[model samples]
Target chain A: MRTLVLVFHPDLEGASRANKALVRAARELPDDTVTVRDVYALYPDGVIDVAAEQRLVEAHDRIVMEFPLYWYSAPALLKEWEDKVLAFGWAYGPGGEALAGKEIAVVTTAGGPESEYVEEDGGATMREVLSPYRMMARYTHAVWKEPFVVFESMELSDEALVTTGRKYQAFLTD
Target chain B: MRTLVLVFHPDLEGASRANKALVRAARELPDDTVTVRDVYALYPDGVIDVAAEQRLVEAHDRIVMEFPLYWYSAPALLKEWEDKVLAFGWAYGPGGEALAGKEIAVVTTAGGPESEYVEEDGGATMREVLSPYRMMARYTHAVWKEPFVVFESMELSDEALVTTGRKYQAFLTD
Candidate 1:
């Protein structure tokens, strides 16, 4: 299946390491099968071209949303994409069938460790944190897959990022 | 206690009746006690002023985030505000005591009915969908209150909106 990876990071080259590495790995996939779009680069002004986005999604069988977790969710621009691109008639509601039957996945890197996400640690589990996306996928009739998360991103060494990137590549292709 | 209600509707004056009513009710409060900010109007370009936002939060003992729910979450600009204004060392990590002991509450209106938000209906409950905000409040050392939700917004009559708005005013003050 053709997979489209929409990477949404404000400073992918400057402030990010793990996400960049992951994107690089995703890019290394055979060109015919995977298409990677750096959403922030594409829309620096924060205005999304709804038609273009819908067309891109229609072209792909699997949609992977890659980003760094901000406030336990995707960046604002990504949210903007959802608000603007995923319209009522196009993505859901009465006549919305554009995204139906497509597969949706999330790949996120978090600065905090996995243990910090539990209730005992006073933080929410990844599942609870990502519930909105899950529900959105359901509402859009897209098949939601389990998320791929890179935890404790701040502590990962260069070698560790490469290892995780390799794993991410396998996950995307699998 | 001084209350700051950051209203993040894309268009409060237009395309919104319930939210406008809510804001009007909020305005009826004593001017010295409550500050209502139209966030989207303040930043038409989607750029948030971090320093000003921090100062606004600092000035208030209670913070109420009022918005029309988009895809089961706050609007994109609100997410942008969270990503930018709630920075490291200011909202979390070390020395992030600016919001400590402050009360944080969410007041939202949903186009869908309350029944659509239940697990049996293949959607997330309000608590689960709003978990990220609750966790963010906890992470920032702020007090998290039960969210105030207005359901079936599209069907609410003008009279119903006024009643709901009055209740919203009470909720913010209480």
Candidate 2:
């Protein structure tokens, strides 16, 4: 299946460790089954080309939104892309069948440890935090896949990063 | 209490009914008690003025983020504003104390009904869907009140809208 990886990092080339590694591994695949688009590079001014984004979605069988979880969500540019690209009559409401049968997934990295996300641990669970994306999948009638998350990303070792990267590549293919 | 209402609707005057009503009600309050800001109008090109937004937040004792739920989350501009304005070392991280002890609330309208937002019902719970904002509140050391949501917004009656507006004003104060 053709997978579209929509990457949303404000500084992918600078300051990103885990996500950068993941991207590199995803790109190393030779089959051309995956395509990566860095959103910040595409729209530095934050203006999204809605039709073009829709066309990309139409061309892909599975859609992956990859990002570093900033302030418990994706970066501002991805949010802008979603609001503009996913229009009323095209992505939802009447006659909105653009993403009816596609598969959707989220790949995100978080600064905090996984244990901190539990209710009693003074943090939200990953499932809770990612509910918006899950709901979006449901709304669009897209197949929702289990998310690929990297917790405690700030402290991940280089060896672990490469391991995670390989796992992420396998996830895209699976 | 001084309250700042940051309105994040793409077309507040044209496409939004519930949001417009809420804005009108919030604005009708005494100027000394409340301030209404149309964020989209302020930044038509989706470019956020970080300094200006930070100043607005600092000026208010209570901050209410008002938006129509898009993709089961806040509209893109609101997320952009949050990501940009709530920067590290300012909103969180080391020496980030700008929002400490403040109160933050989300006043949102959803197209879907309340009954639809449950795990068993194939919908995400309201609390789960909005956990990102809740987590932001936690990270910023702000008090997070229960979010004020108007589900089935499209079906709301004129009387309900007015009532919701009045309750919203009360929510701002209390």
Candidate 3:
């Protein structure tokens, strides 16, 4: 399956560590089946290319969105991409079955640990935090894959980071 | 309480009907206790003024995030505001208490009806869709008010729109 990874870090070069490592693992896939796009770098000004994005979505069998979960949601660029690129007539609405049979997945890192994302603690679980994305996949008739989440992202050891990368590569090919 | 209503619709003037009415209702308050700012218009280039936004958050007793739900969440600018303005030192971490003891609320309009938000139907409920905001409130030590959601926003009748606006005005204060 051709998998498209849309990385939505505001600054993958300067700020991100987990996302950067994750991208390297994605790039290690030795074929044309995996295409990685740093979405934020492509639109520094935050203006997304709707048609080009639509074409990319159409060409991919599996679409994966990679980002650091900021303030309990994906970065601003991912939302911007949804607001602009996931046009009503193209992604949903009548005759908009572009994602009808595709696989949709999310790979995100959270600075906080798993203990924080619970009802008794933060008013939501990690699964609840990701409900919006799941909703999007359901609305578009796409098959949703269980997300890969890296908790305590700011404190990952060097060894754990490498292990995480290997697991992520497996997730991509799965 | 001094309520800051930050409206995050990309095109509130031309592209939005529900948000336009909601803003008008917010404007109808007899005094200055309710302040409405068109956030998207303020940041046309998507460049948020972090310092300015923090100052505004500090100045208010209640912050109401008003927006049209695009793809099951607030507009991109709201996430941008969180990503940039809600900085580590101010909104969370050691000395971060900008939102502490303050009221954080969301007022959003959904194009779909209330039925679509059910877990059995759309894979999530409306309350689940708003979990991220609740989590943000929890993280920042803020008080999360029950959100005011407008369902079937795109298909509301003229009378229903007016009623929704009037209800929104009341929600701003309560």
Q: Estimate each model's TM-score.
A: 0.97, 0.95, 0.97
How would you encode candidate 2's per-residue C-alpha lDDT over B1-174 as one tens digit per residue?
898999999999999999999999998999999999999999998878899889889999988899999888888888788889999999988999999989989999998888888888567789999999988999899988899999999999999999999998888878
lDDT of each: 0.91, 0.90, 0.91
Q: Return the TM-score for candidate 1, rounded to 2 decimals.
A: 0.97
Q: How would you class the docking of model 2? A: medium
| Worst window of 10 by summed lDDT in candidate 2 chain B | B115-124
What tens digits encode model 3's per-residue C-alpha lDDT throughout B1-174?
A: 999999999999998999999999999986568988999999998899999988888888999999999888998999999889999988999899999999999999998888787878547988888899998898889999999999888999989999998899889877
What tens-digit string does per-residue lDDT give for candidate 1 at A1-174? 999999999999898899999999999999889999999999999989999999999999999999999888999998899999999888988899988999999999998889888866556789889999999999899999899999999889999999998999888888
- Fnat scores for every prediction: 0.86, 0.93, 0.86
Candidate 3 C-alpha error for residue B127, in Å: 1.1
Cα lDDT of model 2 by residue, A14-36, tens digit: 98998899889888876469988
Q: Model 1, stretches more than 4 Å misplaced?
A: none
